[model samples]
Target: MAEGDAGSDQRQNEEIEAMAAIYGEEWCVIDDCAKIFCIRISDDIDDPKWTLCLQVMLPNEYPGTAPPIYQLNAPWLQGQERADLSNSLEEIYIQNIGESILYLWVEKIRDVLIQKSQMTEPGPDVKKKTEEEDIECEDDLILACQPENPVKALDFDVSENRTIEIEELPPIDHGIPITDRRSTFQAHLAPVVCPKQVKMVLAKLYENKKIASATHNIYAYRIYCEDKQTFLQDCEDDGETAAGGRLLHLMEILNVKNVMVVVSRWYGGILLGPDRFKHINNCARNILVEKNYTSSPEESSKTLGKNKKCSWSDGLSENPGVSICSYVLK
Candidate 1:
């Protein structure tokens, strides 16, 4: 190897090590040989409303003659926001030519996310007024307008119904989403002690407009039945053929019980072939392990904090990051 190439490689290695230390669990090395890795960044570490995965590919000549290639994976990211983020990343590369710029690029994206969150923050007064208005509208109709303006009262009822639907969603645990070629897969996990609870969880999830819009919401559940000495188990593919069965099979292999796992896939208008199944299973497995549903030590180690290997066949790619498949449209 030439001296310059060796130096570039050394710098890249140092940068990756530093990032791993700095980000800790949020950093994931996907493919070591390809110099492919990703970092999950949130506006707030404690409680983040906006989170995105930054996948970076360092070419052999990185930091010497070539800039690191990157992709921002977030279903919410689209249109001008996506373009602007891409432009900002390019600008960082241009400004820091011949230097390891991953850290800078990450901070830049975080800054943008911070700005986004701030801009989208609802005002206290507006929120309070909306809640008050909902109650007041209902009361006024019930007291005064029961005879007249029935249509207006119906409209108000519909609005309140939507709000109730959103609030009905149970506390759900979400797995870090995996993305490739714009297609994304994320797992939603919820505790369910019975078959009725499983149905409730799925119904609540669909209440969220973004999740309801996913191309596929493959799900599986296994509830332990002490009386019968058998398990109440079921699965649904939602649209993706056989995906539900595969997800349920994974749950059974892990020996997880009283849990419902839903893997939502938002197809990016591309056929991923068999690779799609890999992502779906990975998403399911990651969440099951993270939630302490599995007892295997080896399986536990493969959660978001460790290096999650991506399969490379037919030139397909997979990148994992810390995300809940909420699909929050901005």
Candidate 2:
């Protein structure tokens, strides 16, 4: 082998050894030929059911000019979900070309799996049934829960008075953070019943130095007034151009009410152009879906389809990309 080739191979071996040390012997392995190895990643730290079994093969010019080869396996995931994740891994590799990305790939896949677990319906597996069977099951369940006397249910007696009260909305603090090409996006969601609550939440975000330093802190809020019997909506771009209005419009179309969404972006020194807007909206939409602010998961999927078509319009100007970075608050 040429001198340069020998040096490259030596460096690759060192990297492999370091990875093995860091991930432990069980999680990382090197093949006999020193050209390929496997890394096993689990969704949970202890007793994980979902896992990504990744095999990486280093090319001759790896970490200098060419990227390594990767094969991924996750039996629980299939079809478009698997394909999309594979593509995302490739994109991460391409973004960090000429550098070590095995660790990043592992972490990214773990995060994706965690998100998938949260979104999946929790229950024991049931055998597939025909439409008639489903209908019969639904009928049986309804009959079991219903009261025999429907008319007496609505009769309220003055002697035995009862009142129903609305449940208070819960506080939300978890925010999901996404990064692309050094640019960072964070989405925060909270349930707001009044306009005053919206102002307080926005104030709190701005009060934090990390959030305040962001290049843009675009926000949108929708509140339904019980006394007034009307919807109140507003948005602010925070110097992100038309981002605020777009976010507000998104909430309107999704039929989301009594919620506030804030997306903060920190400049990462690269211009993403129109893709920045896409990322911002995606960040917000993901939080909405994760928090169950929208309807059922099936309906949320359909709403996303409609969102893509209407997100871009003549309202916003096409400007050169700006630097952006962000962090999520707990």
Candidate 3:
């Protein structure tokens, strides 16, 4: 190996060692090849229920001429939130090219997680303390600490905590039934407030005997928490691999919030390969268009089909066997 290449490899190994030490064994996950490193991180240190897993692969010339490739994964992270973090990571690498950037990347992600946590969590006390109030509190503390006279402390009773109940909204099932070959795709849409609601909606859909038998009940959701003022988005591939992520990405691009889209596919015994992804996205997009959730007046008027029959010939070959027929549920 050339001297320059050898030096680059040594530096990369040193950086990896430093990362392992800083993150510890439990938090850091390294692949067998030692080329890929992943760290499990959380927005809140106190609670790690929701976490972001960051993984990076160092190329042969890393920190010398090539940049490390990285990906961020989280159950409830999608849309602009995911894009922003990715962009920041790339910017960090670009600004500090040919330098040890693993540490900087980790710290930058930590800062973003903290900021996101603060936004999602409740803010601190609204009332501000005046200088006079601070002085009074200090004097009280000093008086209480004196040994000459016993401080008379007030006893307070513990109050019972009351739980506030949230009403459950019924799931909305709307879709455009599309068929390609022997496969059938029925897309369903519903408004969801929290992750729990997303689960509930999926459960309700699975309850239907017709939907339960489908080979893949792929789904994606984008919800906005009014209380936290933060966006929550997620996707599940079911048995369709990356189909769920693609659907979720489409929803994010459309700026759809507080909505979940599920595409149930009854496999026709034929493997569609990449074509399945196209069909899945089209099914979900048709529902969004019909509900007017992602369409503007001008765009809708121009794009809306006259006979309610949407065709894919514009993008596909002349003999594409797919057909999308939309239906809006009252």
Candidate 4:
């Protein structure tokens, strides 16, 4: 054979090897109605509070045949969807909940990809899918989640590689400084760090400082001392997301205003499971402890209290993410 023919043969071998690594050994195509092809959730998955996602595609030699697929493999899917992953795999199909979810997913992707290819008068490299769909009404469709590939795909596995459990939300702070009412609290108010009545008293000083403690996480949050009439008026309107009602309820129960506390957390990967919670509580508690809250004797203090708040930022934005919460004190 000529040198050119040998060089072409070598390139073809390299291409086949690369495809095999990605799609695995056995590859197939879709025949009839859409079915599942494969399913894959992240190896980094954790909880309902957070989850992961992924995508699958068909091999180049697709329809005349259909596309391949993939989806999440979970107990809920097996119990709820009554799915058959193997069947989808056999038919080059995909689904979401289980095996079927995988089949639909892969075929959907393949259909769209191929449809785009067949366009005779392809306009720009970046054509809107809708514009393409208007013309090429083919048999398969892209996934509902198809638009956002490279979006936040999750890896559910929590083994040493992925995210480990940190503190759950609604952190507890055992260390709160207490003193005889005479020295501070000149405003004749209650001090609470919740979604309610009290806030951090920036104006007052415990040891002649800016009434601040480096220990608190949700630093300087406060509630106003408004009565029922004003409660509905000047105070912040309640919100389900921002949790005004919860804060207000706490303030009403405490009967104080204009002070808040901070809460912080450290990720403590599954320490038998209990350790993460314990570590979070301890971390917050340590702040209070550093401020001489827990270890201080009752006789040394006029009063004692605990405050809880979470700082879950919105996963995708500047907002805090999910912070599940509950609190208890003695």
Candidate 5:
């Protein structure tokens, strides 16, 4: 590389590093490949529909190959511009680095740049709100995904004849179990409060509380993520179990601290055996970890929390330092 080219390349590397620190693992997907940075400008900024941002990263192959492609979902890139860009990418040969790749790269980049250049501007706070809140921030238009209004999956109800019906779907709830609880030894999780620890925190907080208790053949617990109004059904349990330690062990693996997982086991006529209890608890814990409630709460409280959105690591610099995702479920 020429001296000047080397100097520019080095400069770009340094800048990407800074971004990586700010964005962490997620940064790799958007930051430099050949050292070119594209500023993601969201054209709209008021009440966004989904998270929107400009993604700048060089395609795997470059230079003599195709130039880096622009992931322009900017507020302005919607509508016709979006369609055109979408069509352009459908060209099979243009997918990766290859002969005259730079031409195609620059060509697409040019198209996007021209479109973006003409787009409107977002407010000064767009950057702070979107990345910090994990909400989409736009330059001139708003494209965010608030939990209160998430992008729903296509609405379709199952039928014997199978005719798709598009309409509102009801929230899922397994409902209270119907059975007897006489000899049933009910083990309840105390109300546990954890900042980041997902499993133990919530359950620990609700451990001693008898507020939500019942006797039946079914056992159930909730997984509280950062977002309360979402994925509430991620928790799991069986109506019967002889031992609940397996559930306790699974909690250890997740290092989840804040939210609670309340497992209320009911008595069943026939015992499923002790091994079954371990397996059942294990299953429940896995469901909680998989459900991923840590960030869920943060997301739900996004607009409500005002300005407290932050990564798990951010806690280190602040009052409570980040630690091993530890688990201590009682």
Candidate 6:
């Protein structure tokens, strides 16, 4: 190897070892050869109210000319908050262009979380609520001791209580449908910047008779929040068990933000076993790649080779080429 490559390798090793020592169990290596790793960070080490996982993939030219690609995983994070955090990371990379900056990035996120937690301190209102709950508990205990009057159970009809009407639907992109053992799976993609848009997409998709009739509609979405410097994301199984989680993991792996993907499965009364999940993920990945949410294998290799610089414009961009993934239980 050339001298520059050797130096870069050494620096990477040192940084990895140092981070492991500092973070201990929270630091984990995902792919040693590919230089991919993840670290769990929290606002407070002993008593954490909010936490997130940061995954980073170091390119070969890292610490010399390239920045380590990264992603933040936090389901509660959303909107302008995620955008602001990502932009800050890009700015840090720009400011420290030829140095190992993993520690800097970790601390920056931690600091932000701390600040957020401080702003929402538990005060008199919280104390009052706790006291009220205690009084309710005491009253319930007293009632339990008295058998003079039998307690009557109350029933409520909740079928339409939580309905959210869809006012409009965003444009959706459909991937080529997949079929196996008489089962059909087709993935739908849409751009969403908030929870409201996410709900709208689902409502609109259900308006289509074919989609509504499907056996399962596993979906996942991620939206960046600028104010909180986090992401707001969620997934639903729709009776597919762990299928929703798997779809969400695929989107995370692609580093897809401000977007949602739904895979509708029409079961053909034939048992596919593990093959069902394979077909589901395949449909999702195909649509994500087709929609440019993630790069194809050929493009990924090329991206790694180039010394991609994040300019001011890049800081404002939502996609930064960082990715992570999750698993399905069903």
lDDT of the candidates, in the order given = 0.64, 0.60, 0.60, 0.26, 0.33, 0.65
Deviation from native of the Cα of residue 66 in model 4, angstroms: 67
Off by over 4 Å in 6: 1-168, 295-330
Tell me the lDDT of model 6 at 324: 26
lDDT (Cα, tens digit) per residue for candidate 1, span 1-330: 988788777667656654663455678989999888999888777657678889888878786667777778877889999988887776655544554567667777888888888989721121111222111111211111111221222112222343333323345776766777778787888877755456556766665555778899999887766665445677888889877766765664455777889988888888998678767877787777688887442232222112221211223223322211111111
lDDT of residue 173 for candidate 1: 76
TM-score of 6: 0.42
lDDT of 6 by residue, 211-282 (tens): 778899999887756565445677888898767766665554445667898888888899998667667777
Candidate 2 per-residue lDDT, tens place, 1-330, comes to 998688667656545543553354335555748577887776565545456777788878766556677777656668888788887766655554444456566667777866766777432232332333111111211111111222221122222232212222235453556667767777777788755556555655555567768889899887755565445677889898878866775564455777899888878899988667766776777677678776532343333222221222333212222222221111
Query: Would you give me the overall lDDT of model 1?
Result: 0.64
Clashing pairs in 3: none
- TM-score for each predicted model, relative to the true structure: 0.40, 0.40, 0.41, 0.17, 0.21, 0.42
Count clashes in each candidate, considering only residues at least 3 apart in sequence or on different chains: 0, 7, 0, 66, 61, 18
> After TM-score superposition, what is the CA distance of residue 262 in candidate 2 from its true location, in Å?
0.4
Report lDDT (Cα) of residue 198, candidate 1. 61
List candidate 2 segments past 4 Å from native: 1-170, 227-229, 296-330
Which candidate number would show the highest lDDT if scored against the true structure?
Answer: 6
Please give, for residues 1-330, the per-residue lDDT of candidate 3 as tens digits.
999788777666545544553454324656737588788765455554346677888778787766776777666668988777777766655555555566666666777777776777543322222333111111211111112332221232212231213224334665656667777777888777656556656666655667778899999887755554445667888888867767765664455677889898888888887667767777787777677677332232222111121112222112212222221111
Q: Candidate 2: lDDT over CA atoms?
A: 0.60
Residue 197 lDDT in candidate 1: 56
- Scanning candidate 4 in windows of ten residues, the lowest lDDT window is 179-188
Each candidate: RMSD: 19.5, 20.3, 27.9, 28.9, 22.6, 23.9
lDDT per residue for candidate 5 within 160-213, as digits (tens), equals 242223212212111121122222232223222232223322222223233124
